[model samples]
Target: MSFALKYRPSNFKDLLGQEVLVRVLHNAFNLKKIPESILLTGTSGVGKTTAARIISMCLNCTFGPTSDPCNTCQNCTSIKNFNHPDVIEIDAASNTSIEDVKVILENSRYMPISSKFKVYIIDEVHMLSNSAFNALLKVLEEPAPYVKFILATTEVKKIPVTIISRCQRFDFRRIPTDKLVNHLKVIAKKENVSFDEESIKLIAYNADGSIRNALSLLEQAAIYSNKTLSEKITKEMLGYVSRYTLLEIIEPLVIGNTVEAINKFEEACNSYNPIIILDNMLQIIYEICYFSITKKDPSIFNDNIITHVKNEKILSPTFLSRIWQVLFKGIQEVKSSSCIKQTANMLIIRLCYLSSLPSPKQIIDKIQGNTKTDNNRKALLELLKSNNMQDLYNQIYESDLEVTNYNNGTLNIKTNQVLPKDFHRNLLNFFYNLTNKTWNISIDQNFDISKSSNSCYNKSLDPTVCNILQEFDGAKVINIENIKKEQ
Candidate 1:
C-alpha cells in the first residue's frame, strides 16, 4: 500500500484539515440522525473520496452507527476491504448509463443482509448521464430506512441542481502548508526516513495544498535521496530555483547589467527550468512590491528575502511597477515560444534595457529643467520642420492660430480655423515619432483669434482677399489685376 492509503484516517479524530466536516459528521452520528444521502465536493487529493468511504464504514459498523467505527468488527472490516455484502461502491464515471443506475436502485429496495445499513458510495457522481441521474433521483428522494447514499465529486458545478438540492452537502478545503509539513514529519518518523526541514517544506509547497500530493512528493523525494532527504536533492529533483540563486539572477537585472544577468541565467538554466526561474522571479517581485508599500517583508519568505528588500529600497515604485509589467509579459512569451532558452535570454535582456530607462517623474523633471520653452511657437515650428511635417507647419503658421503654451512635451494651441478631422491624430503620431515620447496637443476654442495681432482679417488689406486668405490659410493672391480677365 502507498503512504496515502496506508495512512488514511480511520475515525473522525484522525481526519486532518477538515474540522467542520468532522464535527458535523460526529454530531450526526451522535444524534442517530445521519442523512439518507450526502454529497462531498472538493479538488482531487484533498480527501473527498476518503471522507465518503469513512462515512460508509461508520454507517455500516457492527457496533452501531458510531463516528468511531470498530475496525475489528466483520462489517467494518468488510467495508474497509470493499467486499461488504450490503455496502456497494460504484465508480459513476464508468457506470454512467441509466441501466447501470437501475441495478443499484433495484437492490436499494431490499433490507441490509448483515450490516445495519445498505450503503452506496458513488465516486465522481457528476459524470453520470442525465437519464441515469433521473433514475437515481427517485430512489434517493425516498430510500428505505436501511439504505444510505454517499456521493463524491471533484466538480460540483457539473452536477445538476435537482440532485444537489436533495442531498446534504459538505465542501472539503485544501490542507494548509504548515499542517501538511507536520503530517509529513510524522510519516517520516514512522517510515524511518530522515529528511531536512527545508526538504519537507519544499515538498509541502510543491504539493499545492493537496495532502495526497504532498505524500506522493514525499515518497518520490525519499526515493531520490535514498530515504534521507536534503534540500539539494529536493531542488534538483523538482527543478526548483533556490531563493539565493533567484536573488543572484535578479541582482544583475536590478543593476542594469545585461551581460552578467544573461550569464547568471545561463548558469542556472542547467539546473532549473526557465519557467521555474521566471516564476521565482515573479514571486520576488511581488515581495518587493509588498515591502515597498507596507515597509515589511512577507513572513513566509526567508531572511535572505530581507536582503533583496534592502537592496531594492533605492528603486522607485514606478520603476518596480515597470519591472513587474515586463516580467509578467515575458512569462507568456516564454511559455509559448518553441525555444525556451532563447526566449528567456531575450526576456532578461529586455528587463535590463528597461531598468536603465528613466521613470516618468524623472523624465518630466528633466524636461522642465532643460527643455527650451521660452519661444514656444518657434519651438513647435522647429519640431514640425525637423519631422518633415512642413505642410502641417505651413498650414498652422498661416492660419489665425496662437501658441498659448508649450512645456514638458505638451503643446497647447488656440486656433480659429476649422481643422481637418485627422489633424489631432496625425499631430500626435508626429510628436511620438519625433521625441520617442508621447506629446499632448490640446486645442482651446475660448482663445479669441479676432484679438490676435496676426489675425489675417485684421490687416489693412482688400476685404475680399483677406476673407479668402483667412478662410484658406494656404491660399495665395499672386495677381489681383484681372477678375474680368480670369472670367
Candidate 2:
C-alpha cells in the first residue's frame, strides 16, 4: 500500500490542519445533531475523503453517534476495510449520469441492516452531471433519518446551488508547511527511517500543502536514499538546484553582471532542470520581497538565504517585483517552448538585462530632481523634449503658467488657456508612465493671457497661423520665387 493510504487519518484527532471541520464534527456528534447531508470541499489530497470515512466510522460505531470511534469495533473495522454493507463509497467522476444518482437514491431509502446509520461517501461530487445534481438535490432536501450523505469535491463551484444549499458545507484548508514537516518527522520515526530536517522541509515545500503529496514524496525520497534522506539526495532525486547554487546564480543577477549571471546559469543547467532552476530563483525572489516588506526573513528558508538576501543591495521591493515579472514570463515561455534550455538561457539574459535597469524610485528621482517646483518644471520640459512630445511641449511653451506646487508627486500648473478635457489627464498619464510616479495635475485658469508679454502677437496673429507654428517646428513661409523656363 502507498504511504498516504497506510497513514490515513482514522479519527478526528488524527486529522491535521482542519481544526474547524473537527470542531464542527465533534459538536454535531456531542449534541446528536449531525446534519443528514454534509459537503467537504478542498484541494486534492487534503483528506476530504479520509474525513468522510472517519465520520462514517463515528456515526456507525458500536457505542453509537460518538465523536470518537473504537477501531476494534465491528462497525469501525468494517467501514475501514470497505466491507460495511450499509456504508457506500461512490466515485462521482465515473458515474455522473442521472441513472447512477437514481440508484443511490433508491438504495438510500432502505433502512440499515445492522449499522446505526446508512452512510454514503461520494468523492469528486462536483463531477456529477447537471441532471445527476438535480436528482441528488431531491434526496438531500428530505433525506431519511437513518441516511447520511458526505459529498467530497475539490471544486465546490461546479456543484449546483440547489444541492449546495441543501447540504452543510465545510471548507478544508491546506495544511501549513510546518505542520506537514512535523507530521512527516513522526511518520519517519514510526517507519524507522533516517532523514534530514532540510530533506523533510523540501518534501513539505514540494507537497504544496497536501499531506498525501508530502507522504508520497517522502516515500520516494526514502526509497531513493536507501532509507536515509539527505538534502543532497533529495535535491538530486527531485532535480532541484541546491540552495547554495541557487544563491550563486542570483548573486550575479543582483550585482548586474550579465556575463557572470549567464555563466552561472549555464553551470546550473548542467545539473538541474531549467524549470527547477527558474522555480528556485522565483522562490528566492519571493523571499527577498517578503524580507523587504516585513523586515524579517521568511522562517522556512535557511540562514544561508538570509545572509544572501542581506548581502545583495539591489533587491528592493520594486526591483524584486520587476525580476519576478520577468521570471514569471520566462517560466511560461520555458514550459511552452520546444527548446527549454535555450528558452531558459534567453530568460536568464533577459533577467540580467533587467537587473541593470534603474528602479522606479531611482528613475523618478532622476526625472524630478531633489530640489523643488522649478526643478520639476525644468525636468518635465527636458523629458518632453527628449521624448519628442511636440504638441504637449507647444502647449506648455505657449501657455502663461506658473508652478504652484511640485513636491510629493503632485504637479500643479497655473495656466490661462482653457485646457482640453483630456489635457490634465494626458499630462498626468505622461508623467506617470515616464517616472512611475502618480502626478496630480491641477490647472488654474485664473491667470489672464492678455497681461502676458506676447499677448499682442497672440491676439494679432490668426489662430490658424499660431496653431500651424505650434504644430510644426521652425516652419517658415519663404517668399515665392517664380522661376519659369522659356516657354
Candidate 3:
C-alpha cells in the first residue's frame, strides 16, 4: 500500500493539527450526542474523508457509540475496509445529480442490517448540482435517528446556507510542519528505512501543509534512493531548488550579468522544474527586499544567501522591486508557453536589462540635482563671505557668472569680466582650508552667463497647488505652463 493509504489516520486521536474537530467529535461520541448530519470542510488531504470514516466506525462499533473504536471488531473492520452494508461511501463528484441523491435519500430511510446506525459518507459533496442540493436539503432537515450523514467538501462556499444550517459543521485545518516531519519520521522508522531529518523537512516544506503530499513525496524519495533518503538525492528526485542555488541565479541577474545568469538558469533547469525555479527567484527577491527594509538578518544559517545579500549593491529597493516584477510576470508567461526554456532565457535577459537601467531617483537627480546643488552653492558663498574675503566674494556674488560645472567639490565659473591674476589658484587653496576638501576651479573670462545651468530663482511652484487643483473637480490653474515653463 502507498504511504498515504497506509498511514491514514484511523481515529480522532490519530488526526494531527485539528484539535477543535477532534475534541468536539470525541466529546459528542462519548456523551452519545452525535448529530444526525455532520459537515466537514477543509482543504484536501487534511483528513476530511478519513475523519468521516472514523466517525462511522465510532458510531457502529460493537462496543457501541464510543469515542474510541476497536479496529478488530467486525463493524469497525468492515467500515475501515469500506465493505460494510451499513456504511456507505459515495464520491459526490461522480454522482452529482438529483437521481443519485434520491437513491441515497431512499436508502437512508431503511434500518441498518446489523449496525445500530446507518452512515453515509459523501466526499466532494459541494459538487452536487443545485437540484441535487435542494433534494439533499429536505432529508438533512429531517434525517432519521438511525441514519447519519457525513458530508465532506474542500469548498464550503458552494454548500447552501440552508443545508449548512441543519448540519453540525467542522472545519479541519492543514497539518502543521513539525507534526508532519515527526509523522514522516515515525513512518520511516516503522518501515526500517534510513533517512536524514533534512530530507524529511524538504518533503514537508514542498508539501504545502498537506500530509498526503508529504507522505507521497517520501514514498517517491524512498524508492528512488533505495529506502535511504539522503538530502541530496531527495532534492534531485523532487527537482526542488535550494536557497543557495537561488542565490547563485539571482546574484548574476542583479549584477546585470545576462550571460552568467542565463548559463546558471540553464544549469538549474536541467535539474529543477521551471515553475519551482521562478518561485525560488521570487522568494529571494522578496526576502532581500524584506531584509533591506526591516534591517533584519535574512536567515540564521551563514549560507550563500547571507553573503549574497550582504553585497549591499543589489539590496536596493529599486533592483529588488524591478527584478521581482519581471520574474513574477515571467512565471505566468512560462506557464503558458510551450518553450519554457526559451521564454525563461528571455526573462533572464529582461531582468539584467532592467538592472542596468537607471533608477527613477538616479535619473531625476542626474537631470536637475536642484535641491543638492543649491546646498553646495550656498556653502561656498558662506565660506567666502565669512572669512573676510570681501573683494573676492563681491566679485563672485556680484558678477554675471554662470556655473558651467559644479560636481563633488569641482567648480567651473564663467563670467563676462576679466578675472584677477592667480584668482583660481588662490580660491582653490582658500576653499580647501575652509572645507578641508580639494577643489578644481576653472574660469572662462569674458563669457556670456546666458548659457548656464538652471536658475535658482525660476523654481517650480508648490507641488500641492496641482493637488489642490485635482482635489476639487473642474478646478483649473490658469497658465500652468507659463507658471512652470521658462524659455
The best candidate in terms of TM-score = 2
Lowest summed lDDT over 10 consecutive residues: which window, candidate 3? 452-461
Per-residue lDDT tens digits of candidate 3, residues 1-487?
9999998888888988889988998899878799999999999888888899999999999997988988889999998888999999999999999999999988988999999999999999999999999999999988888999999999999999998999999998888887988999999999887998788888886787888898898898889999999988988897778887888888888888888988998898888877889887897788778787887755423353655564567788777887888789889999999998788888888888887789888889776765555555566677788898866676566555556666778887766654555667778888798779998887777633344233311112234554776689886544322234677
Q: What is the lDDT of residue 222 in candidate 3?
A: 88
Model 2, 25-111: lDDT tens digits are: 899999988999999999998999999999999999998789999888999999999999999999999999999999999998899
The local distance difference test score of each candidate is 0.82, 0.84, 0.82
What's the C-alpha lDDT at position 441 in model 1?
Answer: 87
lDDT of 3 at 449: 31
TM-score of each predicted structure versus truth: 0.69, 0.74, 0.70
Cα error, residue 363 of model 1, in Å, equals: 16
Inter-residue clash pairs, candidate 1: none
